[model samples]
Target: MATTTTTRSFLQAVATEEVATPLRVVQMEGLVILKIIKHCKDHSPSLVTGQLLGLDVGSVLEVTNCFPFPMREDDEEIEADGANYQLEMMRCLREVNVDNNTVGWYQSTLLGSYQTVELIETFMNYQENIRRCVCIIYDPSRADQGVLALKALKLSDSFMELYRSNNFTGEKLREKNLSWVDIFEEIPIKVSNSALISAFMTELEPDTPVTQCDYDRLQLSTSSLMERNMEFLIECMDDLSLEQQKFQFHYRSLSRQQAQQQAWLQKRRAENMSRRAAGEEPLPEEDPANPIFKPLPEPSRLESFLITNQISNYCNQINGVAGQSFNRLYLMKALHEE
Candidate 1:
């Protein structure tokens, strides 16, 4: 029988749609991982599916005793029963699989860009930084190549247009902090739903960079934007307005490659679901809608934010910190990586 897929929202920041391109990167890695496991697959191999997949933990032993049994009903009292319960819970916790599969699920767990940043940090840490005997993750430069499973180009034009269609210049957006209100300051935040706003305000922990303080202080929750990380989110109108009159080739292709990668992930996920329904083994950790992929498409400078006038914004096209750094060899990186 086909297992019903989980529908709970796995990510807390950006919606699945917005970061679809990046998620494809994870999907490709999962496929590689699955293949690797199967390569060593012996019916009685060294690792069981649960061990490899990180799911086969100890079975549950729902309390067999009825009514706080062993705790004298009439003796309403100070027996050490509570202490025993706590000990048993601790034992169960110990059996938790300390494996990569469970941890990797969160690499693309949809904390929006927050988790993405952490994932990048994990894979990009290097031998030059710290040499070890274990397998080192591929460098950031090679991330897109490893994520061979995604076809993210199909939506490139649509998403690129999203940033482009609403194009506005940084000149229009006075040099101010990028708070939610400031972004939409041309329009103040208002709501007919207090509950959502209250919920949003509650979730705003002090974990983001100092720059996001304005958003942290503001009240927002039920808002449509709670799904997105405010830092990665640009002033849509301002982003387009600020686009340089000139466009570079690499940045353009990165945008398209991102779109292609997302498409590929979606296709693979559908097939995986079919495979599961046919009574094949349930696969490794991954959300079908997400496919857990991210293609490391590097951006070209000259075409994207690198304007002849030296104007720019850290753009969605490049997926890096924004600033004057955009001007440095936008074309060269694109040419080299492409």
Candidate 2:
């Protein structure tokens, strides 16, 4: 009871702190970093997710260890087994006096498709259980292009509340002023290494001479990335258009049904009035129209917003890759003229 009280008090204090100060820093150990990279590379094109073990000191989360969960088609079964495995692993870690608490989990993404429902569900689960949990995203595809992209993300307070309420209604979203950007906040990550480890790494370095023209990074090797991003963007646009068409169709159908209902009601009332004027019994004054056309349920706008955000991401990536290719072309032209 005392421990529970202490934890609650600590959490309350954290909640009272300025929302801008969430996740001040993420300190990742070298071994943990290597393990995550290796796991992601081994999976290659397939998406993989894993659990992280760490300690939270003040606002900084220190990740000391991690383990990858195998890729499986049965997500529901895998989730159950994953939870059991985490529990067992934490138990063993505690026996060895290692940090056993789960700070967050990591997922591998292809391009930027990690902005999907499954990923959001996982983040929500973690945040509900662990107040300061973060989702670390590792993009192996981008890494293969000479850019190692790892980002730490957590849901903002307003987004979290919106998710908890399970109400994705338009009115609620607008009232909260919530947008795609407000859904998640990226936290800065700092890799930490010890002096002994640094010394060992330095000793392991090759003694070969290095040249200054090591421009491998500037090579126009983004053809695959550019093609994929363009394809994905086009597909997303088609999906967005389809959703809009469905919404418009629903609105037109609703308006027509409403007009028919009004006509039916007016006709019934006029008939009853003529019967009464002729000293005949009038029909009951209850509604006589069918309830089948009562407005169809509103389609959730969550999917539309997600597709828009994804389209935006693809555009940004294409622009960046195109810029790099143009720079390389300009360099080649200058060299040829010279």
Candidate 3:
């Protein structure tokens, strides 16, 4: 009886702790960051994912280590093998005294295109097992422009609740006060290193004031990235327009149905009056068999919200890159004059 009571108390305490402390920040080890960068860069253009191992303490999710998921076909057998591979890798890491707790997963994105239905579905799948988890997105393509394009994102609580209900009607969205921007909440990432590792990095630093990386940062060739962003932005706009058309079509059909129902009701009431004048039983005003009286289904706005979010992200990226390019061009012009 004592042991059972202790176990129950412990479980209750854990549940209360989780509910009280929501994830606010992601603390990633410097070595883990480097490993993620290496894995993503090594598979540039071809997207890849890796599982993060870490400790979840208080409001901070600490990512200490990560291992890449092997590339495999989409077949069920291959996916089953992938699952076994992950189990084996985690077992080995545990044996080596590493932090093997699955905090979250990281994936490489192409040109900042990580917002999608598939990503949401993946988050839902992870949420089934983990109470709260984040996806660390590394954009290798954007990194080429001298930017560390790493983002840690999680689905917003309200959005997740709405998503789980599978109801994205305008009314439901309004009730939740959820917009496209609320879909993903980005948690700030803090990279940390142990004392020994920090000392080692300090010693390895070169004496030069300027390096190859600094030169690469000043490169003015951003036309390709800009063009690609514009192309994607246009595609998203088209998709958004399509979604709007669907809503418009739905509204039109609804209006027509309403009009038909009104006309039928009026006609039925007139017949009822004639039957009353003849001292006969009045007919019913509503027709349960009529399809026009049935309510029209509203179109889900989830797709439109996602497209809008993607468009906003693309615009912000383009603006940042353009601003940097302009600064570089002006600096080059001043240098040439000198």
- The numbered model that scores best in lDDT is 3
Q: Give the TM-scores of the predictions, in the order they appear.
A: 0.17, 0.81, 0.93
* Tens digits of lDDT, candidate 2, 60-79: 99888888877755689887
Q: Which stretches of candidate 3 lie over 4 Å from their true place?
A: 1-18
lDDT of 2 at 134: 81
Give the number of the best model, judged by TM-score.
3
| TM-score order of candidates, top first | 3, 2, 1
Query: What would the per-residue lDDT of candidate 1 be over residues 1-338, giving only the tens digit for each residue?
Result: 23233333434333563443321121222333333333323221221111112221222111111111122233335346644653554445445632222212111111122212222233233212321111112112112222211111111232223233343333222332221122100111111224664577569755655534333322222222322323334443344345432334545765776687667766767877998889787555444455324443333321232222111221332333222134234644676799
Question: How far off is residue 131 in model 1, in Å?
Answer: 19
Candidate 2 yields a Cα-based lDDT of 0.81
Off by over 4 Å in 2: 1-21, 73-81, 207-216, 264-293
Q: Number of backbone collisions per candidate, in order?
A: 36, 0, 0
